[model samples]
Target: MFPLLRVFLSDLRRHPVGTLLPGVALAVGLACVVSSVLVGGAYDTAIQRNKPHTPAGSAVVIRAPGTDLPASLVTEVQQLTGVATAQPRQVTSGQVLGADGRPLNTPASIRVEPSDPRLSTTTILQGRLPRGDQEVAIDEVDAQRKHPLGSSVLIADYRTGKPVKALIVGVSAQDLGRPGGIAMVAAPAFATAHLDSTTIYGMDVVLTAGTPVDAMLPRIEATVGGNYQVETAAQARASEQPSPIGISSTLFVMFSLLAMATAVLVAGAAFRAVTASRVRRTALLRALGASRPPLVVVTVLEAVVIGVVAAGLAVGSGWFISVGMLSVLNSVGVSALLGSTGVTPAVPGLVLATVAVALGVAAAVTAALRPAIQASGVPPVAALSAVPDAPVERGAGVARLVLGAGIVLLAGLLAMLGIAARSFFPLLASAVFTMIGLFGVLGPLVVPLLVRVPGWIAGLVARFLGPAGAVIRVAAREPSRTPRRAAAVAMPLAGAFSLLAFGVVGSASLRDAVVRHSDAANTAAFDTATLLGWGLLGLSVLAAVSGVVATTAVSITERRRELALSRALGVTRTGVGLQVVAEAMLLSVVTAVTGSLIGYLYGVAIVSMLNLPTAVGPPLPLLASLAAVTVLAVLAAAGPAIRGALLTPTNALADN
Candidate 1:
């Protein structure tokens, strides 16, 4: 172990950048997951904090269904045994008028602000609370949109079937747990406007010291009778808190998992290229009688170091990412709807940081293990003489082929079942299996076939060009020859595109139907989901871009000897540059196309299961983004290619 550690240290010292690049890719993914968790937690916490709080001791709620409670009920609740104070919660339904003189169309709960501050749930965020009978306090969220301070708000009174004009004297913070806005007016305002036929709607009963909430619940229920709903403060709070299994939380968790998977693919591809570059070094060690076990140990040890370094880097950057994400959410009004706007992201604790580091290390090691094993198994003589970027196998092995086929079949079955049964679990399971079967298991076999499409196009275009045409054709063929490398580069791109297409198409299909059929609460939830989908798409794009750059750069670096040999054989510097650009662009474009199609199908299947309208047209903007990413990859490849091409053939050969 000590000897292997020495070897690992030596290798790491020699190739620090190569070791760190893969780790950096892993770090991006780890950081994304960590930041997402923090953001989600912050959202939950902000929501809870923004809600109306009960007094310090145990509290009971008495809710009368359909009709407002009589004034006698509030007095009866206050006089009940163990009840210290009973505050009546008087609320009526209304709509706030927009600047255009029409109702805002969004429903709101109009609440009476009592003179006693202890009984009031309203927290003034701007100006002063409503004092005059004709003045009111609009929710901060609504004020930002239309009714600012000093603005006149017209309320559509349901009981009178007429609009009541009131001056907005103040703005109060909105409750995050509840949907829509709350409009607050003083107690006299309710009677003056005749908003509701009855005054008292419900009561908040604070129990006395040492009072058991469980014992009080039965007593309150008996006194209030069967029509009223009785609940403890804890239960009421729980109801207001966002569900753990809600759409937003679910989306965050799912995206985090996907981000980790993407990191693994990216880091693995980088490890493969880095290890390939050290073929001669490995051969020299093997020739000196170093066994395979020692070689594997040394490689794994290096991976461990890479993992730890990546984890540290990722953990450090997580907080900034969380803050930025929260800011974006607030700007888009998602935070305003779900919780408080401008709320700080919850700080991740020591335990969370430790877990993030562990995940980073695990992701890095998982990515490197396969490549390390393959690198160590190379025979000394072959490693000494072989090209650095030579293919390990021409095609997928029989075992892999069988396994991939079985998995694909399982995916098809799951997808069909999901559609037939209208089940989300089966559909989600199918999506997972689809990526695993097509990309993870059968990538080598599939990528080569996909490569041929671009190769054929390059071949035809080469005839139209002069010397550069030959380079283009040769570059296109390079990915096909080394199927594993091509597959690794393609995997992240395909997965990202799939998700992109899903988000784009799914949102389009569901938007109109959801707005038409669902109430404001349901519509708000749907909108939030759409916004969260965009966030996921951003993460996927980051992973995709990183994967492309890392793989393309490594591919060019690995072929230093090949490029030098071509230069020796009289290929111009211009030709070599074109070759580099062609390689990156072709691989990126093909994978992007493949991924989009897969993702579109997945979207359609899910939409069909939900019985929603299926969007027909493809997402053009997302497709354009594929081209944009290809250009970015080409730019990355061009730098290394031009730099290497500047070297004299003799110098390049010597360096290789």
Candidate 2:
């Protein structure tokens, strides 16, 4: 055991480059999964924790028919049996103008109540409840600026076309984080402002402890006569299942799984490549009478070591990243529903389980299987011989073209239909198909083209860097020699990047379209800026990961003997590695720039098709996007280049 452990560590140290690449990939994938789950779960938990504060048991919220329950519903529900007390509350959202005339509207919550003990549950942070119709209780967070305690605030009722000057009588901590602009005032004041009490957004029910909510629910429904939606605290909380958040969570999980699966494939391919490259070493061990069992065990041990280290690093990094992201989200008012941006790390069980199931077993099995079998079966002589180039399948070329054409057609059809229908799902579906088709059809042709750009750049650098640059050219020039293998490495990266780019562009366009339509329909009703920000953020994350994967794969490919030879001839490893990194960075930069341009055009086209106004100018987000892609390109290159530098001449030249 000790001998094997020592051998494992020694091997990792010796071939740090090879061992580290996969570990890094694994770590990245693991971090994404862990961070997503932790943040998502925390949001879920926060929503649950906050639901109980809506109202006491048996107290129901009431509103006008087909409208959000009005504050008056609290009174109607209080009249029911087994109900302790009902507080009539009217919630309205609108811009509050400061003295400077700037709009102070940011998803505020307003609750109008008749100052009574029945509504005393509303906790006041400072000052007393409103004594008159002209006074209102403001959320503490909302009162921070020019609207301090006892300050005059202008509440603009867009529906009424008037701004009401109201005195700030009290500030409540409980009201601080309510979604939309929340202000507590006397019900008459809300009525005076023409905020209709007939329409209730939601009703909270406070029932007696011994009373069964189920029996009272139907009766309460009967009392409201379908004019309002009534639910007990338990029912309301249950009903507020965070459907949108749930969908996002599911998407995050699915993407994480896909990333993990990609990591597994990458790990497996890397293992095979390493094993094939190390045939001589395996043959030498066999010549020394190393048994098949011991050989297999050693291979398995290597994978386990790599997997454990990667998982450990990933888990820690992921947790920190998630915490930090949550903090940012909170600070930026993105997740204002969440009072605190703090993320409670999910159960260690979830983290460990993800590592074990997705990364651990998959990596170990992938790394060990091929090596174990080949090491056990291949004769010592064949093992020592150079790897024979496998013949290319002629059919694959035709297949690539055919598949590519089919995918393009399918995506085009979907996009057309989506544009015609003005449906986002169709557009999203089109984007997915387009990405798949693009990689399938254009991978062979496009990757070679993409590879050449880097090759040329590397050659130019070779003028200054010399040998290392030459090695980059050599490896890149014959990309077709291992076209399938090269594509295997490049396709995943391309797919990921294409999807990310397309998704970002598509989502932005969709949001803009939705905003325009909403503005036309009812400008005062909805705001799409928040949605747009979230969509862009998600796409940025996707693009970053894709860039990382692509650059890493290219770096690994550049470290072969051909590369070593270049290094041997006085070219520094850093220079050679730099050439490879440069190529990848260049490809990504081109893709990002091209994709953004195309996406913007596509968005305009869709808007035109919808018969909506295409008068909007170029999106402001594109500049930020370009910056993000540039940063990602630089960061992604670091890992692979470091690996390329560590490749030893003897090891790289041995097989050649």
Candidate 3:
């Protein structure tokens, strides 16, 4: 054990970068997972903390039209036992007048500020709450945009269209039920501005603590009449804050899983390269009587070490990333729109660290398993030879072809079902199956053909340029020679871009629907979508960079002999460097185009299925992401390419 440990330590010291290369992707995956959990939890906590409550305690909501609930019923409900207080809810809405004494173009709503402090859903972010008939408060988002604290603002009566002057007293976090800018005024002030302020839409009934809400519901329902609705506090809150928490949570979980899956693919590709590079060394160990089990153990130990290091780094980085995400959301008014002054980021604890490390180790071992097994099974003599890997056997190729075709057929069936039913679920299933069949199962066969588009373009450009163009043309064709590696690199990029394009198109479709019906823009939903889109883009870019780095590093290791021969044939080092960058750029372009097309079509299908108005236009963010990914891929490959190009031809050939 001691001897093996010493050897392992020595190996790590000798090839630290090579041993640790695969863990970079693992670190990114873990970091994203951590950030997602922390941010999601923090937002949830904020929502719960700032939820509307009442002085009377646990509450039940009773809602009915003003005509159904007369003044007599309201008095009777308040007089009932176990009830502390009953507050009538009304919109009392009016248009917001701008500094020019005209109503603002943006639609607005006004509600009477809760007289009871416990019932206030909003936090006063600046100054004091609205006080009397002369003062009002606006959402913090609105205050920042136009009405500053202490500024004079006007509220135009909804019925008479007469403007009432009021002083802005505070900037409050927007209510969760409200989608846009809103004004909060005292009941007296609301009555002064609007004649129909007394119109009641609902009533908040605060019950005594320890009173069974369920038991009271039957009696309350009877009292409110059959047509009226009655609900507990939890139910009412859920109804009020529909979609934001649900949407955000779902997105966070989906992206976290996607990132983890991408990391697994990246790590698998990396491990394949690592084990292949160590073939001769493995043969030497086998010759020295080391068993296959021992060899696999050694690889597992290395993975364990890498996992530990990656997890620690990921946890730390994730903390900063989660905080940054909240800061971005706050800057864009998402938090304010959701009725939060600001959400404090949830700190990752010991349990979270343990879970993260456990997941990292598990993922690392899973990715390394097949490659380690293959490396161990290689005959000593076969491994010692400087020969290329064997091609897929005829039987295996036939099986893969049959299986891939079957999966593709399944995807088609799903698409047909989706069309027949006019449902999004079946279409989504079809897309997922299509990706799995094409990329996961039939990658070798499809990738070569897919890459030819970029290769042909490079060839056209090469005809015009000189030696540099020749390098690029050669690089473009290199991916065809190693289709498996090319596919591995392309798969993650494709998935990332697919999500990006879908988010862009879907957000646009949703915004269009909101505008068409409401005659007002859904700014809050739009901004929230923007936040999630940017988050997805960041993760995608990280995936791209890490994928390119891992694949290019392995390529450099595998092609030392080939590159040395090229140098001997008078290819300049600068030309070799250009080839690496060109290869990365080409793969990125192919993936971007393929994934964007699929995602756009899927988005359209979803919009159509939902019966939304079609307003799908060019997605600016998607285009920008495509450009950014290509540039980052180039940057990721440049360092390794330059280092590989620096290897003297004599040194490379002589070592091999």
Candidate 4:
């Protein structure tokens, strides 16, 4: 056990990047999950904060700006058994002015309330809360930003588009910061201007403690019947979490799961490669009297260690990631309809950190499972034999290829029929087949072919690498000879990259379908689609790219002897590192490109089948996705590449 502990520490110290690469990849994915949740929290908080608050005791705030209820409806609803207080107001938009009289619309809110703190959440900071028909109170943020206390404001009636003037007498604050301005005014002033009985905005209902909203909702609706809506505070937060885009929260959980799956696949591939490459070492360790199960446990432990480290980094990174995502959403101008809530990273709790770690461990375990089995299953003599003791069966390989092709053909047939008839279900079936069948079937065959690309690239790089080029170029070509191992490693990379491509294309297709197929307005459909696409895009890239790096590192790890020999023969460490990096990157690009093509065709087919106008040409996002994956792949490869380059000849060559 002491020897085992020493070896574990020694391996980590010696191969920091290789040992940590999977963890880093998992970290990126976990970071995305954490940041997304945080961003959503920030957005939800902002919605609750930035919007007009219900009076302090209010349990539910319902607004019907479109179908304004008569003021009489609130009087009846207030008489309900569970109701403590009901406040009614008229809602309208106002173009507020600064002391300098310009269009100041940054801060936004609904409901111009009266000067009572018990009914609303406004904190007066300057002068007094507005009490008269000619006065109003502006948000303190906007007051400081431009329209200060005592500034003249112009209110535009939404129905008639008429402007009315009023003075901002006081400054007020909302618990959550609003990006747009919130203003308050005397209730009489709002009523005097908009006297139409149908123009009553809505009512805020506050239930007594222990009175459930659902219970109170029916009674209130019974009082102020027809066209009225009831919503609890929890519902309000959920509805406003991501404005305009009505994607299900379940989908977000699914996206996070998808990211974890990607991490697991990548980690698994990398671990498998590592295990296969270490067969000789494992054999020696067993010969030295170590039991097979302990060695396997130790091997699995490496992945667990990686998971722990990855989770820690991911927790810290999540905040920045969330902030950046929200900023980007805001920049595109579809973050929300009326307001673009500025997001802060959600405050992380112990639960959030624990979830991240658990996810990491899950991924590590998934990755370690196959490799651990492989390492323990083999006899030490068999393990010490040449890399693979037996020849690959050509008949089995051919049979697999045929089965995969058959499935692909069936998928194509399904897609064509679906497109011809304008049916989405069959098209969906086709996508399932295309993704599962193509990757499952063709990945191995293509991997050997793709492996040659890096070998050719090594020739070009050899010029730059000088002495190291020959060594790398030779090593790069070696994968072509071992089709079985190459294919095994390549399948995960292929599947991961393909999924990345599919997610991007599918999001766009779904958006187009929603716009054309549903009654949702074009603006709304597009906004929803755009947000959804971007959200899924992050998950796809992080998961796939990380998987590629992990797989490549594992594969290249087998070359430790070659790397050590190259170093002893006078190749520079930088050159060796560059070779390893190039190999991983080239492999990723080739597979990603292949996957992208399949994904694009599937996206087009899906959109067409949904009876929507098929988007023409490739979108910039698809291209951007490719570039992003490539860059991430490079980053993931860095550690393993450097470790490989740093291998010493004496230690590596003496392994046999």
Candidate 5:
């Protein structure tokens, strides 16, 4: 066992490239999954914590649509049997000026009276409550801003746009329900804020001790004459339960599954390649009197060592990424409840152990099966010459082609029907199915189509550069030999870029349309242009970064061996690395150009279909984003290319 372990370590050191690629892939996939889970969980926990808590045995009342809950309705509910107190509440949204001179729109809640004064539970951090009209208290979160103590702020009433100025008199210790509480104003001050009418959104009531909430609920409803709904504190909390967490959880699970599946395929392919490349070495060991059982143990041990190390790194990296993402979310005011964004190390450890064990068993079994069969069937003499047979003519390709065509046809029909019906779901379904069909049936057919632009560029460069350009030409000529691997690297990047393209073009178009509509509606009182420009710049940077990272990773992995060989052939290691990096940069540039063009066309078409204002102009931001992504791709590729070049010439030649 010790000897086998020794041999396994030796093998890993010799074949670091093969060992490291899958590890990197696993780490990235795990990081994405873990980050999604942590952020989602934090959001869920925060929302749950902030939900308004009703007093023990308390109930809430809200008037049905045609009007706001009348303050009279609260009096009516208070008069009911077993009802202790009914408090009317109004909630509305208005823009308030922050200290930075930016208008921040926030929700505001007003109560006819403050939460029961006798209870003295609600913490008030600053000045006394409003004593007269025009005075109001702000939440601690908002009060920290320098809205002077006596300075008045204007808020538009919900019912009407009439602006009313309320003097900031005090600040509450805590928000009404959460970190950013509903800004509270006296009812009269609220009324003065241009509210169309004196109507309540809802009412909260406390029941007499020992009064059955179930019994009192119907009576309260009857008192309000079926024109209102009643709810207890427990019920209200339940209603506010974090719905986004469930949605984010489901999405994360789906993405994790997809990513894991991709990892498995990548890992399996890498294992097979490594194993096949080492068949003669294994045969030579058997020729030197290594027994079957020892050989099997050696193979399994090698896989375990690689899997464990990879899994550990993946788990640690994932946790770090999740924390960083959480910090960003916190900064953006997305998850105020999350104090920190990190998965417990224990959870990551357990996940890593599970994934490592799974991959180890898979690699061990996959690596051992064929070698075992060959060893059993033939002596070392015959094994030396043994070669895996070429793929059989199973008509798999034909069947895939047929299935793909059918799916494409179906997708086309669905798309046509969707356009006619103007239904969103149908259009979405059509696009998804079309992608599936293109990926399955037409992927091979389309690869040549997609590669043509790159091929031409490589050819033009090769013509000028002679032998130096052969690397580019070689990659273009035999792309099909590694189509699956190429797709593995390219698809994720393409998807991310496509998403970015859609976001940029769609947002730009939408913002333009909004500005046009706002101009017609409000005569340009709102500066939609200013908002749109800032938003586009921010979103473009985000999309470019993700695209660049994905593209760079794929390019480096796919060309590692070729880059190693170039170094072995007496080419300067730096020169070879630069070539590899250059290849990636070129591909990324092409992808960006194509993606932007497609995005623009698709964006314009959708906008037109939706009857939006169409504006056709050069996409300067898109161009800038593409250039930035290309630079990022080069930077990301450089590390792997240098690693590839560092392989000793002896080892590089030995592999071939």
Candidate 6:
């Protein structure tokens, strides 16, 4: 077993291309998990920093929308046992006026409060905190050069958008998050000056030393009752739960897991093809008295080696990739929730890396399973005779078809139940399961039918390549000759197109819904999700393309004898290249069209079933992704085509 394992490693070393392709796929699979964890953690930190309620280490913050918390409530909270100090502020957004009575060039927030050193989040660099109704404090960043201290400015009412005159009594340090001015004023002065002001949105509180916030939270909540929204430092740290990312956390995780699962299926398909190509060698070993268990062990061990090595590499790759991803998020103006203070990986990163390793190994094992079982089960005599597996029975094909239909029916039943029950969870679950089945089992089935159109196109292709056209035409005509193999390569391509379509089209639907019903911030946040979905979709496609390439490359490799014979009979290299191109085009095009239809439908189904007030159409991304897949597929086949073309007839026939 040891010697066999060593030989397997040696073979991997000898054929670095095959080993590296799958290894890279494993690395990519793990990288998704690692990078998402890194970004998710970083974003968690950023959220707490950006929207900090207790910057002064406060235990609780209470705010009410459309209503002001009377000074009496603050007094009550201050009197509680754990409560050290509770400070209330009137929160509103509006423009400030310059001394000349014209509105200041910038907008500002009104946090009307009297001087309180303990609970105030701001630091007065110069002058003093607002002591009068006419006095105000503004952030230095928003002041830039305007509204200098001693300069009178109007604090506009958020509702009326009217500015009231106030002096810039103090200048606080700039809060990067609140780029607009922050006007701090005396509460008495603010109430007298602004008649329409009512909302007291926040309380900044700090606890006594060694106070436990979590334990005291319930008491705070019970004290505050239904009238106020409450938050603490602990809650802020875990704030993502209420944010867009938190709301969509399940979707994000589902997508990532789907990628991991795709990796497994792809790895399985690639390994299956590789093993199938090695059937003769394995048969000879069996004939020479090699035991079945050892052969299976050797095969599984090879996958394990590949997984461990790839996962190790992926940890590093994911960190760097996460940094890059963070930079992208920053560029896109999502710094509030997605921003990280630094790129350094943290403790959670190690956990993510460990999970990546586990996933990589699991994927490899999953991919190796069926091949191992089949290879071990093969009779030594039949294997030595080089006989194919008994032809798939008509009934078996029918059963598989039925099974595929039943899965879809089950998914539909689940979806209908969700619609009737008015529960989105069931529908969401259906989508995940449906997608898994589509990519895993149904895609290949869908694919064989899609490729049938190419025979007509082959005639047009023949005029350009002459003899090569016939080879391509034959591939189109007999695509199902190796249905299982074709399906292996087709599934991922289909899945890729499907995901791409879902992202692009669904985003369109969400965009419409947002424009009609949601705030600009909501729209912006949804855009972030769309961008993330596209980003992940791109990586999945890249990984999927590799799987397709690996499978197709194996197909080409196994047909070296046939290609070599064609060459002997005077088929030119150009014709072989044409054949390879045709094969890849078939795989790419079929999956693209089929997956696009599926994805577009899925996207539409989601919006419709979710009862969102929007419509989805086949957006340009559907076509764009299809075109891109077609192009990438052609490029993926280029290397194999060149390699196949360069093979010498005698050597190819005599080799494997």
What tens digits encode model 3's per-residue C-alpha lDDT throughout 129-182? 676777777766667666788897887766878887888887765655544456
Each model's TM-score, in the order given?
A: 0.85, 0.69, 0.84, 0.74, 0.68, 0.76
Clashing pairs in 6: 97-154, 133-189, 268-367
Which 10-residue window of candidate 3 scores lowest in summed lDDT?
Answer: 387-396
lDDT of 1 by residue, 1-656 (tens): 57657766775698677657777678878788877777877776665555565533438877777777887888888898888888877655666665555777677766666645555666667777676657787777677777789988777665655677788887776754345555454454554565654356577888888988888889888888898888887787677666654455556767877777877888888888777767777776778778888787777767777878877777778779989988888887787666356767667778878887788778877888888888887677865574554444456789989999999999999998998888878988898798888887898888877767756676777777756666656776777666777788788878888888887778878876877888877787787767767776667566666776676666666777778888899878887777877787777778888888988888888887787888744565576677677777787677766865775667666733
Find the 10 residues in a row with the least total lDDT in model 4: 387-396
Model 6: CA > 4 A from native: 55-68, 75-86, 96-118, 121-251, 336-348, 382-398, 408-446, 460-471, 477-479, 503-505, 517-529, 605-618
lDDT, residue 485, candidate 4: 47
lDDT of 6: 0.66
Ranking by TM-score: 1, 3, 6, 4, 2, 5
Candidate 6 on 108-152: residue-level lDDT in tens? 655555566545655566777786656777655334445677887
lDDT of 5 by residue, 1-656 (tens): 57656666775688665544444444444455555565455555543432333433345544355666766677777788787877665544454544454545444554333534432223345676664556676654455444545667765545654455678776643333322324554544555544444446566777787888788777777778765666666677576566744644564545554555444444443443344444556666667677777776666555555556655665566567666655655454333222222222224546545755575446434533453444333345634553322111122277778898899899888777767886655655665576567543555554435655666676787778776566665545433554443333444444444444555556656667676556442222123332233332333233233333433444444444555566667778767666666656655565456555544555555555676666654555565667767777777677766766676655544433
- Provide the overall lDDT of each model, using Cα atoms, as 2-decimal numbers: 0.74, 0.57, 0.74, 0.64, 0.53, 0.66
Q: Where does the lowest 10-residue lDDT sum fall in candidate 1?
A: 176-185
In angstroms, the error of model 4 at 114 is 2.7
Candidate 6: count of backbone clashes, pairs at least 3 residues apart or interchain: 3
Runs with alpha carbons beyond 4 Å of true place in candidate 2: 1-17, 42-54, 57-86, 92-109, 114-135, 144-273, 282-308, 331-333, 336-380, 386-434, 437-446, 453-475, 481-485, 500-564, 567-578, 583-656
Q: Model 4 clash pairs?
A: 55-119, 55-120, 106-180, 107-180, 107-181, 108-180, 108-181, 268-367
lDDT, candidate 5, at 208: 81
* Stretch of 10 with least lDDT, candidate 5: 387-396
**Clash number for every model?**
0, 34, 0, 8, 1, 3
Candidate 5 deviant stretches above 4 angstroms:
1-20, 43-67, 80-82, 91-134, 139-183, 187-197, 208-222, 243-323, 326-430, 437-455, 461-471, 478-480, 519-570, 583-602, 614-629, 646-651
